[model samples]
Target: MGQTVNLKQRLAYNYLRDGSTKFLCYGGAGGGGKSWLGCEWLMQCCYFLPGTRWFAGRNNLKDSRASISVTFGKVAQWHGFTGYRLTNDGIEFDNGSEIIFLDLTYYPVKDPLYERFGSLEFTGGWIEEGGQVNGLAFSVLQTRIGRHLNDKYGIPGKILITCNPKKNWLYDLFYKPWKEGTLEDGYAFVQALVQDNPFATEDYIETLRNTNDKVTKERLYFGNWEYDDDPAVLCDYDAICDLFTNEHVKPSGVSSGSADLAMKGRDRFVAGHWKGNVCYIKLDQGYSTGKSIETDLKRMMIECSIPRSMMIADSDGLGNYLESYLNGIKEFHGGKQPINPEFDNLKSECGFKLAELINNRQIRVVCTDAQRERIKKELSVLKQDHIDADTRRKGIISKEKMKEILGFSPDYLDMLIMAMYFRIKPVPKRPKAKLGDI
Candidate 1:
């Protein structure tokens, strides 16, 4: 096509052609020629590599057709590549190469695991507006690629993702790790801002610049992912992430243990040992019996020098089994009446306090990268439900709703919030620092 792309697009192309990188994340800001780059690259690959199957996907089919499909048509016209017919579901080339379009919307009741994509085969794929799609869909897409014409054509499995700045799985999996300089092997990220695209029209640039909305200006114009304007959100996005790096929040107050118990299923049992505002995860594992959880909790308390009186466990459901085994331990009743009349229940009171501590940079969480990722995802959805209803009591979104947003229950994050119980109703005297022993 002899079309010229900017430097960031070139960098993404290099990553795609290198064969060593399996995932390449391209665009951050809007109008960085994201759709064009994705479309042009997929079309060229379809023409040059015969008999290879590719997949193009987005949050929904309508979005794909309106944006990505139109861009693909423009790319084909620009390159003068003929003999390819667009079907309702995909595009087919005369050379037997095809690109199937897919809608990656997640429906909990209909297709929980995204099994509809399980039987597909593709050499590569491109996910447009990846920020809008769920992580489970992306994961399912990963498994379906590299299954068609890979060995015969000597092409590696590659998935190109183009999205504006968003704090979803892509941010957790790519941008944050990339910023930390610890991006995993076979993953490459190239950040492209709007100003980097020379092909962007001057009128378009001026319109973006003239926008008055702070969130829109920060996200689309400056590519800032940290600014979130959702009215329901209780905590700041950056402050929630800073839980791992808040070094100034020293360990000095009470040394307590908190656990959110789950037994023999997909839910996880997460326990943490806290020293003042800093918490260290003691145990985070799946499928635990009551006896096993009691044993582990006992061991962790002993290891951390946390007394039975200072430890607390969830009193709901299976946690009752754990509380029964351990006498004299405090039981956290999430449904109980709150100490503060302003809140709806114990969980809501604690949730608001947790948000406050996190936003104020008073909480610190020391855990693994995987745990940190889950914590970020969970805390990002800590919203003040029914804020405008004066008759309704102030509360956080229900656990069921949060579970729908996150694929699993927010076990680790719940443990952190449970630890805030001590802060809500403190002991008569704060315990001395025992960091040396822990």
Candidate 2:
């Protein structure tokens, strides 16, 4: 019976007062006293609820030790809850309501841990850094709350989740759902920013305001999902398309070719030719026979007058088929030589890199406004969806769903990514004239 805490403390106290809240989520920007409030609330719960059991979850084991266990230890000691043992892994209170600290990141997959967690007869639970835990893991933890509520306790169990919004699936599962009003019945979402806490220092407020990047600033200071508004076109699309108006194009030098071959029926085959930083895109209308593709590629190379060595093809899926075919062909001036080509996975390695190049103005696109709009539409529709039993069992969301949700085909984007991956090099320069020639 240390000095009674305030309303913030009572929120936790009331939750455990009878152990009835099904889910309580407290989240927002940093330095809003989320952790301190959570620790205090949890202590109140343990103190009032005689035999109730609770758990504290962290994103990882190390984080559990540094953040939850250590913070709760201080709060427990301050309140005169004497008979407790603090170990590297968890904290156990003498009253039988222990906060077993564990990390959700022990397994990237979720299902294997459900059996282990299901065995626990927990009254309730808390997730610190809720943003980092996968949505699937959170669902599994929710199932474990059953142990506390029964004919005897007659009180419904609950979970307390606290986190700062950051990149991850949590934003989709928790924050987005809260915004959309789609969270399950009996769940409550309370948002708190630095301004909400009188304890936050002025200097901290100033630092948050000074962050220049809009995304970082919005997330940390304003707690909004601010999309980047920078223009998608690297070069003025109108200006670049104007350059290609003259049908008789002269080669400044050998051009490089990059292809993104479509293997999935829904995707498209896209190829681009780059001379210096300028790129010309060609959208494949249909999947042609292997021989037809080889012929088309050879014809394009001959027309562009680009040597085989300078060409690079995407080596994923059907692209690999094309690469193998071209490797065996013997039609170039270099005497039966295969095109020295490169390959890349468009999603993981190529896409973001290309986005960076566009943002940096190191790459140029034709910038067809209609095409750009279509691509944007597709990207906007991308969503997390369940794919299979493996994903459903593990609580994992599918990345492929994002692509499908995007309405327009991502073939062109894929091609551009592959092209950018292959074309990355030190900016080419002409050899200097003899020193005396100027």
Candidate 3:
């Protein structure tokens, strides 16, 4: 679909052409010619240096065949790689240079999945949908960078990535530092929103406009760095912020809460401690391992005063490791039986119950504006489902769905739910009088 490269594409090409940097991460929004930049850069390298080798792929092999194949095929004729063998798996250039298409799905998230990359080497590579690949995978890929091609041609090993504005490992690795003006040397990031692409059609622009959700609007069209908003938001973000403003409310004497734990990568080890109606977030960070989170929990217990007994930590997924290590902490299984009839499971009950608390002005979150805003963003994307069965069935959106929507797990919101549900009181009954009434 692209006959000519745009301005942002030219900028990335210049960086690669000049050999000004070893890494170039391009494109922020869709239709900004990011994938094109990756392919073009590969073509330029192959043209200049004979027998050059490269690897190009996305997280899903099937998607690679469907989308990237067409993008590469369109330019293969112009670049004289026309004798290539194109398939669902890879493309082989006629010049003895190879572009191996790796389905990174070969490496899953848990355990030592990315270690498989140690078996292969490449001169350079490009990761499409860079958000899907984890940091560990990227780190391993970095080792394979300088191994595949010759240096006599003056083409240094390069790694290019293309992705939308998603808050994932990419955000932490590239965007955050870039935003802070402290992005390390030898790396560059070029952000191209939809407005930057003059080639964007009015019809496509209208489609992005129809998405009324704030995060979706900011991301797909405006390409702003913000949370992804689903159709069903558990709580009103404005209402949650308002709770912090009411000065008449006092902290209750009892102190309790719950936690959502992650050993490392993707999820965070988060805990929210409740003092009366307010929840204070003591742990909401990432880039850790099983051993580190346990240590952090123990340290936070002493420093932040988090009551160990009252906090119920998530017991599913990696949280199992956290539960076993954190002494005296309660375990919360989201799939367990729900206390309310309207909910399909304990997780659903927790979400709806937290919504009730927020709606009634019965809860508050004591934190910095940034913390509150982050919590609100996570809360706003919590979706719900109503199964159309003969008997009504209500369920909270699975963490997997939330992950797809936000590009990562909702750690803080899960902690918030667990903590508030811990404070839910059981119903009471009046004492019965003896037979003296007779």
Candidate that would win on TM-score = 1
- TM-score, candidate 2, is 0.58
Off by over 4 Å in 3: 1-4, 18-20, 76-88, 106-112, 210-214, 229-276, 281-336, 342-348, 355-363, 368-415, 422-438
Locate the minimum summed-lDDT window of 10 residues in model 2.
329-338
Please estimate how well model 1 matches the true structure, expressed as its whole-model Cα lDDT. Answer: 0.86
Give Cα distance to truth, residue 363, candidate 3, Å: 4.1
Q: In lDDT terms, which candidate is top?
A: 1
TM-score ranking, high to low: 1, 3, 2
lDDT of 3 by residue, 1-438 (tens): 123677887787776666657677777776676776777777666655667778887886787776778888767765555656775557766677777787666433454457667778788888888866655556678788868664656567778988888656677667777888988888888897767677678788888888777667777777765544334555655566676765555677667766787655656777766777777777776777777777877776766566767767774665566656776777787788876666788878888878877867777778887777567656755667754454765777787766654556778888887765575554565579789965
lDDT of each structure? 0.86, 0.58, 0.71
Q: Which regions of candidate 2 deviate over 4 angstroms?
A: 1-21, 77-89, 108-118, 148-151, 210-216, 225-353, 357-416, 419-426, 429-438
lDDT of 1 by residue, 78-132 (tens): 8787769888888899999988889989888999899999899999999998888
TM-scores of the candidates in the order shown: 0.76, 0.58, 0.69
Model 1: residues with Cα > 4 Å off, grouped in runs: 80-85, 94-96, 203-218, 224-231, 241-257, 262-311, 315-319, 322-328, 336-345, 360-377, 384-395, 398-409, 419-438
lDDT per residue (tens digit) for residues 1-438 in model 2: 564444444454554454445777776676766777677766666666666777788877788878876677677667776766777657666776667777677453454454567677777778888767756667788788758744456767777788776534455545667787897666666667777767679999888888886655676688763232223322222232333343333334558776655543545666667775566765464465556667778787778766676666653355556657667321111111112222112233344445455445455545466655444433332222232333331111123444423323565655554554454443356789997988
Q: Could you tell which candidate, 2 or 3, scores higher by lDDT?
A: 3
The 10-residue segment of model 1 with minimum total lDDT is 315-324
